[model samples]
Target: MSSQQQEKYEESELYRIRHSAAHIMAQAVMEMFEPGEAQIAIGPPIEDGFYYDFDLPRPLTPEDLVAIEKRMRQIIAGQHKFEKKAVSAEEAKAMFADQPYKIELIEGLETGGVDEYGEPLDEKPEISFYSHDAFTDLCRGPHVEHTGKINPSAIKLLHIAGAYWRGDEKRPMLQRIYGTAWKNKDELEAHLGRLEEAKKRDHRRLGKELDLFSVSPDVGSGLILWHPKGALVRHLAEEFCKDEHLANGYDFVYSPHIGRGQLWEKSGHLKWYQENMYSPLDIEGNEYYLKPMNCPFHIEIFKSRVRSYRDLPMRFAEWGTVYRYERSGVLHGLMRVRGFTQDDAHLFCREDQMPEEIDRVLDFCLHLLRGFGMNEFKAYLSTRDPQKSAGDTQRWDDATEALRAALDRVGLDYEVDEGGAAFYGPKIDLKMIDALGREWQLSTIQFDFNLPERFELIYIGEDGERRQPYMIHRALLGSMERFMGVLIEHYGGAFPLWLAPVQAIVIPIADRHIPYAEEVAARMEAAGLRVEVDARGDRMNAKIRDAQNQKIPFMLVVGDHEVENNVVAPRLRSEERLDALRVEDLIGRMQKDIEDRM
Candidate 1:
């Protein structure tokens, strides 16, 4: 096969393997349950694995998973050949009469509707079934010729969880069996190892253990309550970003959390983004909404006064907090939240300055991300989706080329996402690869032509003609809550010296040394270090352990010898100890690290 053909064959193989694995798992599940006791729903191949949903008579347990997995291996060993046969919708319905979910799917296929998995057939296509031995399922197949082709040892069922049918809460809840299938056992083992490491570094667990944040039942779901330490870290991050923005020629701006319905309607947010927005609240006689984005507010700032070309490249920055409605099932700790503060900014520049501005913004994004220890970067240029976009074709092409040129000028690697742009215009999305080789999208520079036109925003040029300046929307850190969550997991809660909530802790060897430790902490604090003196009556080792648990970068141990000499024995979190150093010397070292953003 040619290279392209070979690539397609390999992809088809993996898809077939995963798709076949789901069927085998479903068959095993049916065998384990009593006749007519379990009804199989949709089984689909997703990223990294496959999952099959079933409406079981009872909740699945760990022991049940083991049993189902054992039976699946037995079925694989039987070496059943997969047989495909097309059937009319009427025949499919009759064949799956006992299975309500399958019957529902057949009905959808007959009526040219969407199935529970969201697979829609606008015009009814041929319905088919794939059968292996006595087990069969409605499907469109490109499956392995036989079950013997599967490597049973390379596949394992991971876990079982509750899922609502079609992802709708109102629908019947089903048991979803999540499993991973690989071409070989080694790859399976590697994937399992990554899962273990990911679990250990799970931000939700670290958040609670480190006392950084909490999501309480009383506070409602998808809402985060940053603890004191977490709040300090968040505030420090915002302060650093604000300082950077100011230095980069951005004017700080503020807007209310709620705006009148008319504001959203004028911005086209109500028409285009209403599904993600929260229901409007009625105040007096008008409707108000919790702002889902800060773009419209920044646009209002741009329109506050008419301007000549002198103010063409106006940058407005805000650490604006916004709210949106998220389904309960998808709300992860801080990674996905209902309310978050976006490091949002907008740049309005003349068309002549558009290319240069794009280049500058891309460079600035890389610089800011590097300061956070995210140096590896790649960008995706999302061009306008022809069917959904609103702007004229020429403007879209120009904006897309500007973004591409910006990436090329910076010598950055990028891929084009042909139709990934928002409805308004094209955009460039930057993804940062973290310490674990996981990619996180942290910055976006989007071009908008539709909004300015909708709002009738115009600036007078030197030629005395009203011209619509190109509007660029940028979010550097994406959102405070999500970024903090990523940061917590990125460093595994052992933040670098500059970003650690408590940079150092002073530990006294005894009660007599308490005053000296406090003095040491005071000196460090005066030097702008975040230091705390551990004054508890606990043993010295216990205090050190507590500081380590808190991931404090430096632990300053002050004994009589050190105190008398006005020095501290510095202990690093990595368990490295240094000889007694003068307080001034230690502070200077810390100051250097902070300056370097270590």
Candidate 2:
């Protein structure tokens, strides 16, 4: 598609609202500061919000946000008309004389207008500008017709942060203001409310409260310190993944954290993934690199043994932990980390086996996600970036067509990401929408024609000839850290009975009932449930509150009356169900829940 067509496609209703909101935000910032003091850099619309970078002597504060937001409301209330104008290169440069960023943008546009043959077109597309009242900005048109047409109550300032100009750290730092705009007042309110609830359910906050994990600045960024509780959860998740993979005919394998640099070279990772990889270290006169991906190692395992066609579809799975050098600024809590364990696997299959192997992986992925109680999903069929790709046309076509066929065969409707695939191959990414309506990328099934060819992977065909095998790389849980983050948010920290770090907490009202609480805990543990006894010398209400705060799914409150009747009061996290039940009966149900992995 043409660039203009791409722009048109990108401009959705929400995009227009956010784009117009950016202009309004810039106008607000300009008006809030003293007349010639405020210098604007760039204001762009992002997902669900608008942010503008600014150059100012004084750093903006919370109070400044309020003042600027107030001015924005005033502008919107004034109902100023937005006018669009087209001008020549000279006229555009003159209009943007004081705006360095705008001048740069216009110059780039002029250069783009030149033909490849070195002759500029006679009818060059004119530079466009949008004007609302006294504030004007160089922009492509398609904004709201009038400021008054916007819902005054539907826009809000979210936060302020420092960002480098054009995202380059070497450039001058600019203060960035973020805000969200919605179609209506109600939607805006709902969006803000969700944000607030999300904050309450943030895994980072819960991690601290529950003593789960922490990130220390002293330890460097993007490195996680998994506390005891967090480690227990991680262990459970990994075990669950291992069991699922085993049931799906996968052979478990272990690979080293670091491999010889030659291995990555053979797999083509050294060339394509060098930026994300750690610097190589020399060991005994040989250079070695930490593995960025587990695929190359698994492929080495496959190629170790000369395989007949019977072992063609060799499925190798591993909870391989690897490290990647993510941009420091992009790291946030455990969701984005430098070191993580990927539930990675690769199936070396013959050409004819690709479809069935992919189908099996998809089924296993669905079942695993369902086991974790994630039912809602969004699938993307990501194809090659046609403009910048290393593979030949035939291989790209074959890989992309294979993915298309799989999706079609399953009758799964997925959106196509025009150029979202990795440089190596086409892939399918599954993003699960949690109960909170947040999307998390959890599963990926990717095809790699480049790796097998680069590694010269081979399998004996039916005709007794050596032929290249197709490789499939799959990661059901993108990473343990991120998946745990999503799981915490999915269940709001009250994990399912089987997955909860502490499935049941036995609470004794007083010291007298502590013995009975121990008995109940023992019975629960015997039934294969994770149980803890709260024997603190605190009151019953305090203990109950503590359990609730920890988000324990069930709190078995034991007291004298319960001991007399040989029963316990089962209190749920929601406080909706508090019923007296026979201890054995509840134990039976808990055992069933654990056994079923529900």
Candidate 3:
């Protein structure tokens, strides 16, 4: 097979194997626990693994995982044939009679194939079911021909946790079991290695170890309390972004945290995003809401004045804080949160300026990612879906074609997601791959035809007539909290010189060398470096170990020998290599690095 075909074949084979593994896992859980005690919901393949959500009588323990694995191995030995039979909606409903979630799914399939809790989709002609022996699921599936093709040893159940059905807190809470399956033992081992590496760099653990930030129980879930160290890092990140934006011709703008409900109605957010928003508060008999997005505020600023085409392609940026209600089950340490600041911007331009403006934004996005030492990226241009979105087909085609033209002009390759655009318009999303090969959505440039229409925003063209100007909503570092989480994992808590909370730690070789260490630290600080002197009376080895554990970028040892020479010993995070340098020379180098933001 050709390389492209080979990739497709491998993906197909892996999906079949992983999906089958999910079923076997569900069966294994059934065998271990009593019927009705453990109920299974949808189990599908994610990026690297499959997760099956279930509702069980008791929480699964580590011992339970061991027992469940044995049961899975026995089933794999049986090698039951997976018989996929297509059935009608009624038949599917009957087959899943005992499973309410499945029955709801069946009802949804019959009624335009929408999920139970989803907004309804337009009618489609055909929807079917797939069955594997006694376990029949309401899924539009393309499973493996049989379970015998799956390598049992390549599958391993990782952990168990809770997830809300359909990711809605109002829905039933279910147990989510995560597992990974690969085509061969070697691939499985590689995947396990990545997972282990990810665990080592998990931001939550690193946050505690480095004394950066915390999510205290008293502070509530999904909310971060940034300690001094974390705040310093965040402030530096914001300053860097601000400086870059200023240089790139972006005007800084700020808006209120709360806005009247009428503002959302004018922006159409009240119609589409009300569910994700907190309940409005009645302020003096008027409804007010915490701002869920900065687009409306930016639009208001644009509408504050009437302008000719001379002001075309105006860019306004804000580090605006927004609040959205997130389900507690999906609440992670900092990745998913209730409130966060977005590095948001809005670009207003004439129709003729779309292509160049998009190219400029793409270039800016690339630079921003590179500023954080990220280079590998995947770009996708998403167009509207006729069934889900509200827009004329002609407009969507024009917007999508415009985005494609922009990418082509910039010579940036991107995938086209045919039906993945927002209800308003098409968008180009950029996902950056971190050290662990995990992708994070760091930047997005989306066209907003709907918002301009809703807000009735217009500008006087060269023809002396008012015309609707195009709006682009862009967010680099989508959320400050989430981006910080990504940064922590990417750097393994060892940030580069520009981003480190404490760039250098001055350690005395012995108790008698404290004064010299303080002097060295003062000199570094005066040079605009974040420096700390370890005067804790700990042993040199212990201090070095602590610094290493915290992932400090540079450790400086000041001793009698070095003090007499007016020099300091430097150890970098890259290696165990050390060098002796004069204090002045070290300060100059450090200052240069900080200035370069390297």
Clashing pairs in 3: 54-175
After superposing all C-alphas onto the true structure, candidate 3 shows an RMSD in angstroms of: 5.0
TM-score for each predicted model, relative to the true structure = 0.82, 0.86, 0.81
Give the alpha carbon lDDT tens digit for every residue of 557-584 in model 3. 8888998898999987675746799888
Q: By lDDT, is 1 or 2 better? A: 1
Q: Report the C-alpha lDDT of model 1 over 1-598, residue by residue, as the tens digit.
A: 7776577533677789888999999998888788889899999887678999999888889898888888888888889999999999889988999999898888777784775466775666678999997689999876888887888888989889888988888999899999989888898899889888887677788898888999988988988999998998888788888898899889999999999999999998898889889998999989999999998999988888887898879999999999989988778788779998899999999989999999888888888877788766678889888889887788888889999988889888889998999889899887755434567677899998888999888999999999999999999888888888888887889988988999999999999999999888888889999999998999989999999888899999988898789999999999999989999999999999999889
Please list the Cα RMSD from the true structure of every candidate, rounded to 1 decimal place. Answer: 4.9, 5.1, 5.0
Q: With candidate 3 superimposed using the best TM-score fit, by how many Å does residue 209's alpha carbon deviate from the native?
A: 1.8
Q: How good is model 1 by TM-score?
A: 0.82
* Residue 319, model 3, lDDT: 95
Worst 10 residues of 2 by lDDT: 112-121
Q: Each prediction's Cα lDDT score?
A: 0.88, 0.84, 0.82
lDDT of 1 at 524: 86
- Report the error of model 3 at residue 580, Å: 1.0
Per-residue lDDT for 202-235 in model 2, tens only? 8888889888899888987888999988899888
For candidate 1, what is the lDDT?
A: 0.88
Q: Cα lDDT for residue 390, model 3?
A: 60
